[model samples]
Target: MIHSQVNPDAAEALRGLCIGLTRQALLAFTAIVAMPLAAEAADGPGTTSTTGKTIALSNSYNGNSFRQVMVKDWQNVTAQEIAAKTIKGATVVSANSSVTEQASQIQNMILQGYNGIAVLAASSSALNGVVKSACAQGITVVSFAGIVTASCAWQVNYDWSSYGKQEIEYIAKRLNGHGNILEIRGIAGDSTDKDISDGVHAAMTAYPGLKIVGTVYGQWTSTVAQKEVSGILPSLPQVDAVVTQGGDGYGAAIAFQNSNRKVPIIIMGNRQDELAWWKQEHDKNGYETFAISATPSISQISFWVTQQILAGKTVPKKVIVPLLRVDQTNLDAYLRTIPPGGVANPPYPKDLVVKIIDANTNHSAMPPVPPPAP
Candidate 1:
């Protein structure tokens, strides 16, 4: 989720090799990395771990529910690993959504000689230089959720581009391929934001009849999204569908309801509030939509990956975690477990993490249920 407020006039710098990759390119990239990794090749100089090496988690923002759950999950998982003697202890450091501040904090972590670093990058490209430096210093850097483009950084994230395409395709199908739509985007200059936006644009191109009538920066928070959407609803003309990056869909729905306008078909994010509303709406009008998002639990994968890397296990440079999807059949099940404002999914399980580590280390297979736990 994005951290800043919307300010359309402000110019922002884009970072990293954040260019969109074609489906063919994505497939090719994944396939080429499917070979067994040698221990020496996997661990660069000084990368090997001792019995109790210290590691740290670096997060860019702590503003949203997703990030809060993400940090909590990271801390819980790290504590479990510590109890099991995987590492001595762990520290978590976060900065207010500034790429420069994040970079500086990461540099400080490197200087502190943390054995490994698990990071949720603030900007896809801005942290490249710092991540590379950390890797060069033999600090295993595992980036997740919002990924970094540094080749030296190990990435663990869902196929965000695919997520956008699938969700938009969902709405397009519901609309019979023709309708005015509202696009509530996340932060303006963030990499994940860019990737998801690219995916949405790609879908629009594929379905020529579908059009984005307006776009509002939601900053990926519910209150902000509600306020922004409320202000714009009066002007939008018959929006047939709503597309949003996760975390703000509920707010959008609220805005529509409050405006006394017929709510458009909205692709729900995995937040509990959204899912609960989705359930209620489904019962009332047979509203049908799937829930999807890059899971907050991805931080655990990053942590585990860092441990694997530091342990000299061969791993893929890019380990893609697939988007979690919850449809009508499983919606109730998800709702049963998730409390209000909770993420619909739990952290990836220990068994799944083992599967990922083994599969990637051997390069002989892929994990079952690679998506976040539903």
Candidate 2:
């Protein structure tokens, strides 16, 4: 009965319409399937802009060349961001290596309505109370170089313990697992100092013939390191090598030079002065040694990480920056790029920061160090 008056043209038109609808539906399904992959490819932690946030740097000490460069890098990077309208403002404050003073400064920052605070803490655990208070008020906190232990705060740090262990291992190898080492420690209460010292002691156990015959607090300042090393050298036996936390190597070398003892193998911390001196010595008498340091530019990384958080990016709680290392092969390359008296620090742009974030998120190896700035 339904087919009694069927029109061929009408039936054909209806079939065409159904085919078009089916094709459209298939396309819609395909688009839906591709949407997520497309978004994942384009989206990243740095995609969002932090256009109006304000950040602050609460540095513990401004005593050493490293800290000076750290602060300068932070200021320079933040100034660029401010000029670009990425952030509203950035302020830097340094305490005299005093935890009490640093805590007071952070409290002032909270009162001043800063959106984020990047801390180079005076004491890792001592700042927990102030850091927690900032987090409670919804302020983002990121610590680097000298990190804090607050669970809510994010940390961008070198593996300092591993740094120390690596230092000792290098010395062990250089001296054939037998030598008297002068350990030039950093600030007395600082976590960086303790971690590196602990690593050194732990690694020393593996090489029974190697010994830390003397230890001095360098305060991580060349002048202080030189003074302390000079003060203690009289009491110790001949030191075959000096293992140092950065900013102290050149000082240790100076102390040895001032005395009658020959300049032993001093592990450099990548300060320009240290590298220059090493280069001089190498040219004169074939001196060879290893060098490593947590780059001062890491402050820039912390600042960007803070900005990302403020921009609503989901970043990991801990991001480890690789330490810069120089040896006979690459020493000239590093020296050629670094400014005199500056540490071997590369500027960490937002893209690099994002890459670091992504790597940490995916639990993958970090992207390789970019070529030194020309």
Candidate 3:
């Protein structure tokens, strides 16, 4: 969290991005308009009043990465608003990718008296129970990232189905519709893998010319993907273009390197942190990969989601942020566009999100009776 307290100094910096820095200020300031006494309390310890505030963030992450950075940014932004005297404090409680552990964490947060909770489900099915229990407590719950269901109170996510369609479309065009393609899936049970693959199959179903040579699951880790690719290459005939979920972009390049093949491989993925390596590797080896941000900078979404909830505004039950394609051509273009507060928001109200989701409801996608391929 860069600034737990709002810095008027931040105004100048935020103005440059034109992200409605003024509007955020205006609305926050307006909250204190009719009631001067509440406004007086804005300067006090600030925790005394929790009228329209206090959100407990329960995130699903195992390590530090873009997602982690984004969460940190969200914390900083929300804290700034609180310090700026916008609303009350929003407390954030984090948990790694364990379903049982995260569920326990949510229970703990509720016991601690948190009013609202933002969660990233470990597994779409596994976390449904957690969401329901949390909602039963009358707490607001928002789920995102690898989470793909519409069951949560609200879900802010990237359109993985669209992301998959676009990447496959790009590969299909590059190969002129006929080539051997390899797919490295993300975390096996995570909603991201299912939605993206669902979109890929939805698109590829029509493109019979493009043959899927070999399929494997990488669990969204570069090391696992590297090993999986090394194993997949020997059994396959040839790889024309490859599409993977995340760091597998680097892994695909490594796979191509291992085989010492001349055939071109295209990697479609997210994660701007890898840009430095991507540039250096491509420049040195002359063979490179490309990617599209599967999910928008997670940091920006957290703040936007938090703000929407706190402002007493109604937001969509589900918000799907789009991704930007990054090849060698425009990699630098998006470099500065990432991190917290990256993309701009669409035309929507502060509370539209609430109307779309009924906090009392519980929804789930029935597990495909047949288990997925491991």
Candidate 4:
């Protein structure tokens, strides 16, 4: 039986540190501000001299939103140790969001003879061949972001199915076991979305009275999610609450308010702005869309998990970090926690990019002023 939770180390650091700080959060800011250095440190200047283990990193996408932060976190941590000249030189290959590109990149990496591969899969199932081949060649394959098939060494990600189950259960509990729910899905067909959607389906089954009145595909965008919800609101029965797969209650609020629906909505998405808006909603009640957010702390967790693998520890096939539920009670701290980039990347010099990043030293004491890119 898949269990409910895990004991997370440094659990306190992740909470509120990146969500709602007025000034850049000392910790969150440290993580982002120092990320460049941390990553550089992980991938030292020289190659094949230290402990002598080659680790190849390939990412699915490094754009914006939740997934973007996740990818960068892995890169940053990897840089720290690599920069310190402890491990062998690390090579990062990417394909943005294209499965074919990722496959090609992996094939190339294998031909070049890397010891292990860390990949954030573009498509969970589509990457099976690459993963299988890597393992066949005596390479350790680890999937950090999405679901890679069993052929990989470890899955350091939140279980999507469980993400849905826990989030929906929380929503049901908030609504006193009965309410009209509007479902918004992330980019359709993505492994995370599918897992979360399935978990929501499973969780809602336990609460039969909780009727999911409307279902729409948000495609994981505020604008798209808003339009989708906007169209559904006019005719559907009044929704008592909402359970969406992506974060962005602002759009959901616009949709809910447009329908003249005034009920609590639960968004499974996490961003600093979510907490900021919730704080405003709690006080003024203007845009009172949602009070709580179920954030998975993917950025922080992914970074630490990769460190374990690089150090040659036995990583669980799947490490499902506990969900952080934030409401009015913790709104202030949460909002203050999200720094400029918070979990996402910030502008930095190309010279500093790497795989492992140490937060304490090897960083500027304060954020560096952007020296206008040449």
Top candidate when judged by TM-score against the true structure: 2
Error of 2 at 265 (Å): 1.6
C-alpha root-mean-square deviation, each candidate: 15.0, 8.6, 16.3, 16.6
Ranking by TM-score: 2, 1, 4, 3
How many clashes does each candidate structure show, in the order listed? Answer: 2, 0, 11, 44
Q: After superposition, how far is residue 321 of candidate 2 from its true place, in Å?
A: 1.8
> Which tens-of-lDDT digit does each residue in 1-374 have in candidate 1?
12233234433212111222343466567667643334425433224554578889999999877788888988998888888887898999988999999999999999998999998888889899999999898888888877888888888877678878988889888888999989999999877788898999987898899989889999888888999999998888999888889889899999999999998888888899999999999999998888778778888878877777777666778887657787788888888888776886567765576566665555645554433335
Highest lDDT scorer:
2
| Candidate 3 whole-model C-alpha lDDT, 0 to 1 | 0.62
Which of candidates 2 and 3 is the stronger one according to TM-score? 2
**Candidate 4 residue-wise lDDT, 271-347, digit = tens:** 55445555556677543333323332344444344444556443446554334444444445545556842421222
Model 2 clashing residue pairs (backbone): none
Per-prediction TM-score:
0.78, 0.79, 0.67, 0.69
lDDT score of model 1? Answer: 0.81
Worst 10 residues of 2 by lDDT: 1-10
Candidate 1 TM-score, true structure as reference: 0.78
Output the TM-score of candidate 3.
Answer: 0.67
- Backbone clash tally for model 1? 2
In model 2, how large is the Cα lDDT of residue 99? 97
- TM-score-superior candidate, 1 or 3: 1
